[model samples]
Target: MIRVAILISGSGSNMLRLVEDMTGDHPARPVLVASNEPAAGGLAKAAALGIATLAVDHRDFPRDRPGFEAALLRPLLDTRPDIICLAGFMRILTPGFVDRFAGRMLNIHPSLLPKYPGLDTHARAIAAGDTEAGATVHLVTSELDSGPILGQARVPVLKDDTPQSLAARVLTQEHRLYPAVLRRFSAGDKTPVMLGSEGLVRGS
Candidate 1:
């Protein structure tokens, strides 16, 4: 089984799904859940599930991104993770940190990608009159949210959809897409997964 480590910033809805799905012969098992915020709700959730948790409070290193990452690296490496899944991990990792794990790191973004790469993605999509909003699971790279895509799950915007509503739908897709991608990815298959209504049933 692959030793998977997940990082989170806030409520770990996606992180929760990733952990739950890695059961019953799944190729991966979540061994650690790390957070930048000590009070992040996800830490509690992870602890409840009996997974080891780490809190490297970014605030402790006011002007030192590298320092914070170094602190973050210690616990992450201790787990000897074969895969690092960034599920809503808010911090932008330094390139040196990204290089440490390279091909083994992955992230889930709340947009179709190459379309919306940053925060407020749902709001931006609505403002742009986008008929569709979705999620993308991609390899982590130095550039923000510009990594090679591994999977995408699209949801259509209603006529009067607000960012809040659009985000809800897209998040549901993310919960599904991230885990599906991770399962296949753990097996060393980077084939793009396409999420359908019934679930991730095909590769692109």
Candidate 2:
């Protein structure tokens, strides 16, 4: 089975979903759940599930991105992960760091991508009168959120939807989409996965 290391910054809701999915016949097993915040709630959650957890606090390095990444790499390299999943990992990695993992790393963004690349995706979509909003799981590249998409799950934007409500619905799709994409990706399949808001079923 392929080994997966998940990086997180907060609660790690996506990490939980990914870990839970990696069982029985799944191609990948979660080896580590590491975070940039020492007090991240996900650390406790992961440990509770009998998964190895780590913390490499970015605050310790101050303005030193390389130093932070270097410190982070020590434990990560020890895990020898075959695949790395950035599950709500908030830090923006440097090119040198991203290039090291390149094709082996994956991330789930809060937007459909090529539209809202950075933060505030839900608000942006709603403000623009968009009828749909969703999440995208993609290969990690040096550029921010611009990598090739491996999967996407879309939800409708209701007329009365606020960013928070819209975000809540999209988050559910993310929970389903990320794991499905990772399953295919870990097995060396790069074909895109399209999902709808109703369930994990494929979308047109």
Candidate 3:
């Protein structure tokens, strides 16, 4: 079985979905859930789900990214995960830290990607009069949200949509897209999975 470690920085709705899906015939199992904030709510949730949890609080390093990552690496090295999932993990890892895991790390972004690569994606898409907004699961590279795409799930941008409204709908797609990508990815398949507003379309 593939040993997976999830990193989160907030409520971890995506993390929960990922964890819940790794069961029965799933090829991967969660080994740890670590966070940058000690008080992150996801830690409690992961613990409730019987997953080991850790907090390598970023504040302790005080403007030191490498130091923070070094501290974060201790538990991760001890756990020796085969895959790392960044589920809402807010920290921007340094190139050295990113290189440590390299292709084994994955992240789910809240936009179709190759489009809005960073924050405020829903708002940006709405402002630009986009007809569709969605999510992408991709390999985590040194660049911010610029990794090779693993899967994409698109949702319609409604006429009456606000950022919050569009985000809510897109989040539903994220919950589906990330797990689907992880399942295929852990099984050694890199073919991109695509989902439309309806459901699974085709691997493109």
Per-residue lDDT tens digits of candidate 3, residues 1-204?
999999999998999999999999999999999999999999999999999999998999998999999999988989999999999999999999889899899999999898998899999999999999899999999899999999999999999999999999999999989998899899999899999988766755
| Segments in model 3 whose C-alpha atoms lie over 4 Å from true places | none
Task: Please count the clashing residue pairs in each candidate, in the order shown.
Answer: 0, 0, 0
- Predicted structure 1: lDDT: 0.92
User: What would the per-residue lDDT of candidate 2 be over residues 1-204, giving only the tens digit for each residue?
Assistant: 799999999999999999999999999999999999999999999999999999999999999999999999999989999999999999999999899998999999999997899899999999999998999999999989999999999999999999999999999999999999999999899999999766756842
Best by lDDT: 2
Instruction: TM-score each candidate.
Output: 0.96, 0.97, 0.98
Cα lDDT tens digits, model 1, 2-106, are 999999999999999999999998899999999999999999999999999999999999999999999999878999999999999999999999988999999
In candidate 3, what residue range of length 10 has the lowest lDDT sum? 195-204
Query: Which is superior by lDDT, 1 or 2?
Result: 2
How accurate locally, in lDDT, is each candidate? 0.92, 0.94, 0.93
**TM-score, cand. 3:** 0.98
Task: Pull out the clashing pairs in model 1.
Answer: none
